[model samples]
Target chain A: MQHPVSEGVLQRPLEFTLDFFGVGEHHLRAMPLSSPTAVINAAAASTNRIKLSTAVTVLSTDDPIRVFQQLATASALAPGRIELVAGRGSSTITFPLFDYDERDYDMLYASKLALLMAVNTDESPTFDGPHRNRPLRDLTIVPRPEEPLKIWLGTGGSPNSVHRAAELGLPMFLGILGGTPEYWARYGHVYRDAWAQAGHPAEKADIAVAVHGFVAESGDRARATYLDYEHRMMADGAAELGRPVPARTDRAAALGAGGMVFVGDPNEIADRILHLHGLLGHTRQILQMDVGGMPQRDFLRGIELLGTKVLPQIRAELGTP
Target chain B: MQHPVSEGVLQRPLEFTLDFFGVGEHHLRAMPLSSPTAVINAAAASTNRIKLSTAVTVLSTDDPIRVFQQLATASALAPGRIELVAGRGSSTITFPLFDYDERDYDMLYASKLALLMAVNTDESPTFDGPHRNRPLRDLTIVPRPEEPLKIWLGTGGSPNSVHRAAELGLPMFLGILGGTPEYWARYGHVYRDAWAQAGHPAEKADIAVAVHGFVAESGDRARATYLDYEHRMMADGAAELGRPVPARTDRAAALGAGGMVFVGDPNEIADRILHLHGLLGHTRQILQMDVGGMPQRDFLRGIELLGTKVLPQIRAELGTP
Candidate 1:
């Protein structure tokens, strides 16, 4: 009789992706933001073990209590498998919807973020501030998780955001999709330096590099697939800016090739990740797989291959998990 | 051989108490606010299917996010088993702990409560405010139960609190434990009048009356037990207040005859409840079964007898569930 395999050994372990930075149609089209439940449940069901994250659940356009509540519930359901990368989201739709001005976005985020952190603590937190104020009410969030929930501020290369995160002693998740790998290195350096200057605890600051990636047997096939998606996304992004889509090859190539989209085989993809890691000293890297209506099957295959092949090699090369 | 029992007949039906209010030790002690989880869980597990409620959870003293998280989790575990009676809890502990002052408490509750309701909505909420602000963040609370979570503001005869709850379209659970039943009648009138003035849809305002109770076969036996517990509790309460304990009295006779404590047989208990209901227009009543460490067994027996005997009679008489 053939030997039976154990469930643990034979189970098809799917790779996990950061929930924050999925490159789906919603992210590219800038339509109404999609419900976070679908992606969150997908991560929970799959064997990916990846932290479900939101690259930046913009605080400016979002309610902090709501954000924390939703995220906290998701975290409870999944348990040690979620991260929140909070930022002032890019879309201007929130300003008009909430009757808020862009000028006050910074102050709004600062105050709300402070209140959010304070509220998440063990004690019933009361705060008096410009944006929000509560009196001496005894309150506490119920069903606090066993582990303290992790919150990362997703910064779009903003020094103030970086400094704020450091001052608050929260981890920084840099959005490196728009800039070069070298720029990430500089920002990472500034983040760490600021963190040090702020006299935070000795725990090493964690940095996560978020960028898009696609892989195939051949480089040409990967490039073609990436370009088809990139073109549409760039057009939509340009429309949001009320500017004509720039046709310049150099600009397009710079945007495409500057560590944002890694197109190649496993070895080549791993190499690009390593290069970015080297520059930023980032141990965590989020490869956004579903950019711009890329087929779900293709995305799954990429994640599968990354988990099966690329991640192991990258970890070995980096000497870390 | 015995015939097989039908599925419906064989099933042990679930039992429930229509409504009840619980006093948190935090407010009773006036120092070192107790953990909400401990208080809530203790009340939930210890009490029968009575609607377990915190007479008022001081929202200003604690973090609304944490409170909601805990309450949501508790509700999920119990399912129609928990009701949150939120208030600007009476105490100064929340201020120093959360670094908040008394002045900001009202706005804090207003903003946080708004955000709490917004987040629980189906659509992602966009909010802007001075104290607690969130932009148009696409988020949803996960593991939300099938039933609408019951949220009540514990208004201690405050028209503003009652008006706020009506304006927000939430229920108000009044705290009418301290004074005469006639006082509650005025408070109820004010709440209904404010509800009308708010011009919102007329939703039922749940006025829950919390009172102390004692029961025995003989009135004399009940009265003796009641006085012992009352005198001890009064002394303990006075000690906490840093005031001299009042000389003991036949308060058991006065309050019992005054129809505050239901200290008599099952018939008398039921009658007292009905009279209070008529006086205050309250449909729900929570008896403080365990008053100042009256024997646990006695407390359990008192509640058990009430559940099995007094409640059915009260229900039949009042035409309520």
Candidate 2:
């Protein structure tokens, strides 16, 4: 899953400078805010609390050492609040931009992930890899963060990805369009089983699922409002991934039990959340309310409904309140 | 002359993040915060006004297109408040890190600077340069800024450097250790002459000067407080560049007429500023108060003195509000 969040923060650190100047006073800015970590560093200056993470940093086409340094620097600014979710991004623009061949995706991701892990684990690492400029010896990355960061493996239903996360004992995050929660929940089980078989503690296995959805005051309103966006999204958005946009007549069935679309009012959405919880036992759930040129007012209303209505009901039903 | 001010800004975008956090209630932290542009991007979120710039981005070992994007992104965030001062940094570490040889420094800098200008000017560019991975064609950078940025050329004292800045028709900035103002002023004359010869408007030529200085209540106290730090800085910092630090006995003499060091009471420092202005005719002057690891309280005091006492006198003398 090319997480929209990670890409935004990674690519648009300079975006915040407007806030610094326009919003209030005494705001600081960074100069070269091109990379994600750099955005985090600049964020450190503007805020006191709030955990920062990349939704999914594309590991296949990036330099692991530099990536580690970037995250480490942010750690220095805001200790214990930095996390990284690594995956192959939704787009392939980075491959040619960074001078990498798309064919090497598998080997590149694995090798870069290994290097990132090594850099985090050891102060001085000596590695002979296809990507290294030279063998490093006892080299140290500076402005050392006060604490180690948590790394989450981001995947989009690839079986191989689940095994890789399990083998690494990394936390897992599933990103996708809304689909069969019951079947998708099985991927979590796969991760858990592999993690347990790999000798990791059973309790360490965790999963987070993010899907496209919206919350509204009424079930009908939610469906009607989201239908148009869903239609456009499925038609053009999924076209690149080879997923056919289904017939509009099937929308109702798709929102039923074990369906992909999650359009409904607070109660219906809460019920769906509970259903997914019961099936998958996911630790966290995220909803993407804005997509395919969503209007700002509708998006804001959806957010308000989710926060003030749906979430409270979900919490109470899940026995978490 | 790699202006120390630009170098400091380019290299330490991370340090400023602390200010963003510690000074306020609603702020954020970044993960990598490694690059100057990223810091600027994050800064955009926190502020609205105040021109942000890279003191010196070391263009020789960096990618100009990416650099332009970094600055451009900040421009989008902060609008007309973005500036770039480009220079070759004082360190040689980037040569090996970026896979460039020392021998190609001159050619690499010229080529890269030209590429940066091209990307800023045209939406699509095709080039066959020695450093490009491939010829770029019909590409558009995202978040196009509101206005063109102001780019300044930072130089220390190299004759060739002066000619390059003049030929490029970019504003010139002089960075130096305490040097004779009358002697140093000659570089400005040379730049103007070269700029005129290059057919640039005479009124467009501009110069800014920066040097080491400290302001206190008295000359004796200033000398006493800054001596040990100066002694250590000269000995260690000079050694890195293969120069010998001056003797302790020469401190007072160095602060006299035709001197580099600017240590004195606020009135005295103010007098020196006007003195340099008279000789060098610099439009702007920047003083470095903290260097060689001086205590924070002392550095803060020096800044306070510069603001409260030195600046008032200097402004009054110069007849500027």
Candidate 3:
């Protein structure tokens, strides 16, 4: 008797809402940053089964206490449905305005993560570091959620960040935009190996990959729309990195075509995801359906299709439970 | 009609709840140094109407991000009721556990506070400090409260802390269990004057004092309880400072007799508060009703009496509308 291999699927679809505050567009009217409470409440009301997360909350320039409290509150409000994916967000505006030196990014993230993890524990922590000291007090954080909050470190193609997350026993969220799945294989290996060496339990290291996705009724339409959106996004990202936006269409196409973007129908998109998963061993995949001037309605429709059609089919094929 | 010269009583009853997660006791528990979130949450919820604070959250030894996030979340939940009254919390446990050098206290607070305040602003902040760095991005803190969150510097009779708070336009909450109210007056003046000179509005330089408060149905019971609590607290404080608890019964008697503690009724407590207000010029006062395992029932009763009877009289006398 031949047995079919089970393809991996998330127990249920995890719902994550990208902040509506449009980024990278000069013409876009900046929306107010949504409150953590507002985001958590909205996510809670929208889906009963999806895991809610902030794509990446900037940690380097933020107060750890506030972040912990907000996340904890959200966790309490939605029990096991919330997780915080934090990063030294890609913005220098928070630094100069807050009067922080730009060189301490790595140290800041390290220290902040350490402290954040400590404070979430059951004991009253007394840390005396280069930045803080305090006597031991019987401290308690209020409105704690039912489950321990999961923290994922979001890294923009940084190996050190991946290793650090492993060292800290935190999950890793890798940004794979503008890169091929083959590029992330090394990071995945490093993370898994580090977790093993650290003696953490098996499955302690979780890896998630984020990719830009655009699906349409027809392949040609999807490709065209994806190219348009990709061009604009690449230009903005390049400019933000202080690099000139590539003027040549060939260069733009080259950058987007093989990168972690899926511009096709259900089967094609699913194949791309499976290929990346095979390479990176990532259980969680975040698809950015809306990017760089993509119409909101189209984006929503794409997401709906991905959730209702593509994801289920992929799960069955992959034999994911 | 000619009105007689009447002094305006300022009864700014600022209730501060400092969670002293007894470092020694927590260490004894064989748990990690982090304080339990439940305790903090309970305290925050319990003191809903008061100025909820961590007397000195001891930032030097902890992660600023966690500290800020936790407090910010609490503040958002409570709106204007929360204040992160942080200090270089006393205790060396965080140093070894978190691998911190003792010399980094000043740098840590300054950098952390700068980062915290920057993130709290409407604009994306930028900073290039020795301890941290980030490029400008369209970053904004999610879930900011409607009212501005207050950050108070908890000072251990340190003039530098007072000046720092003043210079930064932040408030100061002084812990004054051992010193005379007169000692804080000089610091208070410096803070106010510095704040004014720093281009802050006149109303920005607020000062709060945290003191021990004990009230009883009878003067004798109050005195006995005050003596016991004060003795143990002073002894513990002295031990922490590497000094002997002072053999000064006369001073204790004077304080008790003069209404610093061991007070009779609501009226008497109110009168003592008025006197302290005159001496310290503190607009907000946090009274420590529970000291050294004082019976929970007694503590609750004292709180009720103060909130219902004592506060009303004091507010009325102060013409607080």
Query: Each candidate's DockQ score against the native complex?
Result: 0.05, 0.21, 0.05
Tell me how large the interface RMSD of candidate 1 is: 15.9
**lDDT of candidate 1 over B181-230, digit per residue (tens):** 67667777777777778775545665666666765666567766776786
Backbone collision tally, model 2: 53
lDDT of 2 by residue, A6-79 (tens): 22432222332111100000001211123455445455544545556665677787666656665665565556
User: In candidate 3, what are the lDDT values of residues B1-321, reduced to their tens digit?
Assistant: 000000000112223122221111121121212332212332333234544555666666554444444444445445566556667665554454444566776787787677667656643456544455444345444335456556677876777787788888888887665555555676677888888988999876788876677666765677666667656655664554455767747545445534334255777787877777776567776666656556656766676667676777767778874
- What TM-score quantifies how close candidate 2 is to the native fold? 0.79
State candidate 3's DockQ.
0.05
What does the lDDT come to for candidate 2? 0.63
RMSD of each: 10.6, 7.6, 11.3
Candidate 1 residue runs with Cα over 4 Å from true position: A1-153, A159-170, A189-205, A212-258, A262-272, A287-321, B1-153, B159-171, B180-321
Better of 2 and 3 by DockQ: 2
Q: Candidate 1, residues A1-321: lDDT per residue as tens digits? A: 000011121122332322233311122223322333223322333323446666666676555544554454445445676667777876554464444678888888888787678656643566765665444244544335446568788786787888888788888887655667777788888888888898975466878876666766676677766766766666666675466885734434633446466777778888888888888777577766555557656766676677667778887897865
lDDT of each: 0.59, 0.63, 0.58
Question: Which segments of candidate 3 are over 4 A away from where they belong?
Answer: A1-172, A178-206, A214-259, A262-281, A288-321, B1-153, B159-170, B180-205, B214-271, B278-281, B289-310
lDDT of 2 at A104: 82
Please provide, for model 2 over B136-213, each residue's C-alpha lDDT reduced to its tens digit, 9 standing for 90 to 100.
544443334566567777777889989999999988777776557877878888998999999999989988776777
* Quality class of the docking in candidate 3, CAPRI style: incorrect
- What order do candidates take by lDDT, descending? 2, 1, 3
